[model samples]
Target: MEASDARVVYVHGNGNKVREDLLKSQWDTALFGADMGAATRMAYWAPLRYPAPLSDAGEDPIDGGPGGPVGFEAPDAPAAEPPDAFIARTLAEARLDATLGGAEGLVPSAPGATGDPAEAEAALGEWLRDMTYLGDTLAEGESANTVPGSDAGLEALPLPRAARTAVFRLLVEHTFKDVHGYFFGGAGPAMREVFTRALDAVAVPDGGALVVLSHSLGTIIAYEALRERPRDVDLLVTVGSPLAITEIRDILLQPPAVPAGVAAWCNASDPRDLVALDHTLRPEYAPVELVTDHLVTNDSGNHHGIREYLSTRPVRDPVRAVFDGLASGQTQ
Candidate 1:
């Protein structure tokens, strides 16, 4: 079969997103100048997380697309917190313990503690100071210096330090929430079902190439799905994935190895992308030789944006090569 006939299946990451059609179009434009017609498909699972899709006018907080950052209210009811091992581990790796602690301090003091308004005000001030220090430390890359930008690549964002910290906090919260829901909220089977259906929908004929492109939490979904039901995937591309984290790896169907159905696995990440802190999957996954990892600069303000990651050469070229018939078992 010719490479032009190859099919591409995209799996999006966490958080409520725009309508499925719009989301797919945005991704299509970023990866390919124009839609590939029936050659491409998106496994959209946002409806499972949010009751309704965000209006076209609203900005996706996670993506930071158009309209800038928007205020997001916390969930009114406490979400089920089944074993937070993944959340705890991810925060520690990101060095956000202090930032979270400061946020906790912002809450009103206990009933017995301070009746005086003056004292309460003082406590609030102290918490603010601590949070400021923590934010500065993160921005300066003192403790969580994983990315080139001291602020984990958030410094480039136009927002002030406090605002940047809040944005990062929200991002982390939403990211872990979705991940937790997928693993423990009884959403795993359903999410994987969505992926399975999409994969099966691909019209690739016998011997035709098939590529799976997944980002962030989508990477986790793709990995497990491909692992559970082996298929002939010409290439599996993952970006901003948290699969490298030990906690995440531990919970997945063990023993860790490249999905058997995948002929070649290419993982790309920006050094500043906290979600993909580990940056490389070659050493962790089994049959290490088959997994190739590349580091690219994601100019997206947050450095974790899917569009920026998709636009990078390391990512775009490989996918394009598969369609161009230039890619073999491994990406050039």
Candidate 2:
């Protein structure tokens, strides 16, 4: 389809705020910015809590990741020890000064930790200030950091400060796994409501196709939400997402509503991502049909971040194909 005729709605991963700037950053710096033309229209959404609720229990043991409603094989290697353990080790290795910043930042000596009460307040203040500083530093006080002059004339310009603040708080608190569930597990019910509400607010104009562009957990949310409400979506895309995870595949087909009418489903992933283990969401559940599966590999070793992939031909080619297919009416 012609780029001008397509509308893309982006649902971001867990612990996220559905804000414009972050969406632009993901597209420009990670997804569509490389050879992919910015001509395609786009928008993004996140969970209700901004940063959704979190669980530190770790990846599902069955899936070798974290626990969820899904099934999985146990992780081959012992799951890496939780960060709290590392904190314990740190406290043992390095003596913490109770009076320095007070007891807040000090690594607690054991589980269900307690700090010196006298210093707790002071330590809490210091930590809060540090967090506030980091938040402002990351975006330079903006809710999201955007790539300048990438794609112009896209609607939803000039992101709101209120939205940014809400998003900032959400992003800061995200535990990563819950972010993954935001797209899966229907994020329970409240998240689904936020998604539909946001999509409605965007209001795709008549005479143009609207595409749903999602990455990581966002892809899962898009797919499940569509299963609930399929009318507005034109195409669905998943990049560096854990939707391919075994747990999710089983849920879609097991005696429940499955994703349908997606028009075209495209999955692009880098091998380096530890979480994007698989891409096929049980081919049986697709309402439309998947086009092509691209095993694009990016240098970003970080499982969730696809910095290099977005700059390469792998991401560009498939996105361009989706655009071409939509513009030409061939994707369906």
Candidate 3:
């Protein structure tokens, strides 16, 4: 696994409250090791939305500190409050706002929830996996997101308002603006800066592989960025991604698209991870030649956690292949 010339760019997803260095260090430790943090590049962009001089007091201010369960630990805390309560508290606390734009797509598509608990429950279960720490901290109640039924497909379930708002504000609002703007709205320099920085981090040697690892909404960002600006990518790994969500596909740079130079697109998601509600991108991405989807089940109660997805065979197998290719000077 001699990767001296190869590079791995990690694009983080939503609700990142820790400092970039800390987040980068944590992810590096999770993905590689203590020393590898410096080797792995982080596309730090949380500050783009929540600029410096950060504060806990504001209508939509980000709260950053060392809190909640770290990594993919199962929740053993008592379920005294409903999942929504913890979500509500997290929403109030996260304050992930869209300063330049407002809400978009699916979040508004189903404003009010439906009575059939089956679909909603299944979706909620998926979302819960992302916020398992909230599951650990809150007291259980009846109204929280608790999805039932077989986890499958691109249907818009009747998710509760609290849960809906939380997802919308944290993941949707935070990412949709940049992505949509970049493709449709003729995004300005800020978005350009993001793409610029992403490309700059690669610095892959002439024959070395470029591995782009993205989590949650970061999948959207990485996909679109690569699609618009075609480049050499040996492996594109998306964990806990929402690329299959019909709403996202609707306004993508190229509807039903894949990046030009990407050798392989490996999408991994837990069936219960609501963020990855759609689960499979093979259908929408069409032909399904280069794309492969994996059902990496999370045993740690919260399946949506990036750490859980990272630990699965889906991520490890392809990643190993890429490194092996780099070592052998061959493209798989």
Candidate 4:
């Protein structure tokens, strides 16, 4: 192994309205503090899926590849019923979740998973049995473990089926849209362009020492890009990610569940984060030895917020390790 300059690339999780500057500022503050300037970049794809409102009026997607921020927007498709449906579902859930105050309280996830790896695995096994998908991963006759994070601490009870279904549906919508855009929706090249730029930018004094911080749908893009495009990332951080969720996993480009050039994978989740319904990744990606799961406090009104995860020690420690490696001349 050799040491090289490490660059951080960020992929923002969810939301149509997030601005790149805002995302960059928040990530910079969280991952590197406000003062430290580092080799960090972001792979932005929100403008592809989210259209600006008429009142806010921004440039539309065009042939040179969508308008707005040069690397942001993607070609707009004909007005479809799905967007309308997504809006309706989101609004409906917003009302219901607000009323219940279940957004933060219902899912009392453990602060972190420590001690026996086998013990943590056993606990997740017990919890999944109560969920809709993935019950067979556990071996026959495993013992139940105390629920942690999003999976526990509900001084209250679980959400009703309807509320849960609404949350699930709303989330499922984002994954579906991302997959559609990244593959068939003519947005593939746009995403590839971002990866290309970041990879090139990171090749500073050396050739390719990269770090990717992908959130929500960006995780899907990063995974596919890392697999198909192939680059060197010393550390891969997924914050409030949906990669473990069955909806997205079923659609991954490669079933390896791990990217090709990543030296280490760190998965940080706030169990209370609705989008990260499936917080653990090692179970599905067991062949990989370097995946570290960090269950941290989101500290946001809504547990799934990316800023919250980015600020946690669990997330920063892994990223810092990469920079430390870079400083020591450790190469991937």
Best by TM-score: 1
The residue ranges of model 4 lying beyond 4 angstroms of the native Cα positions read 1-4, 17-19, 35-38, 50-167, 173-189, 328-332
Per-residue lDDT value at 170 in model 3: 44
Question: Candidate 2 lDDT, tens digit per residue, 1-332?
Answer: 23545555556554433244544554654555432334433334443444542233333221223332111121232333232332233233223232223322212233333434324333333333433233223222222211111221111111122222222222223234454344333454565555566566565546566666666656656666677776645556667666554344544523323345555555555432334544334343333234434444333313244344455453555455545655676334
Say which candidate scores most in lDDT: 1
Q: What is the lDDT for 177 in model 1?
A: 69
Task: Report lDDT (Cα) of residue 290, candidate 1.
Answer: 69
lDDT of 4 at 139: 17
lDDT of 1 by residue, 114-134 (tens): 334334334433443443333
What does the lDDT read for residue 40 in candidate 2? 38
Q: Estimate each model's TM-score.
A: 0.68, 0.50, 0.63, 0.61
Q: lDDT order of candidates, best first?
A: 1, 3, 4, 2
Which ten-residue region of model 1 has the weakest summed lDDT? 147-156
Q: lDDT score of model 1?
A: 0.64
Q: After superposition, how far is residue 46 of candidate 4 from its true place, in Å?
A: 3.2
Cα error, candidate 2, residue 119 (Å): 45
Per-residue error at 332 for model 3, in Å?
18
Question: TM-score of model 3 relative to the true fold?
Answer: 0.63
Worst ten-residue run, lDDT, model 4? Answer: 147-156
Candidate 2: where is the Cα deviation over 4 Å?
Answer: 1-3, 16-19, 25-47, 50-176, 179-187, 252-258, 282-284, 287-291, 306-309, 312-314, 321-332
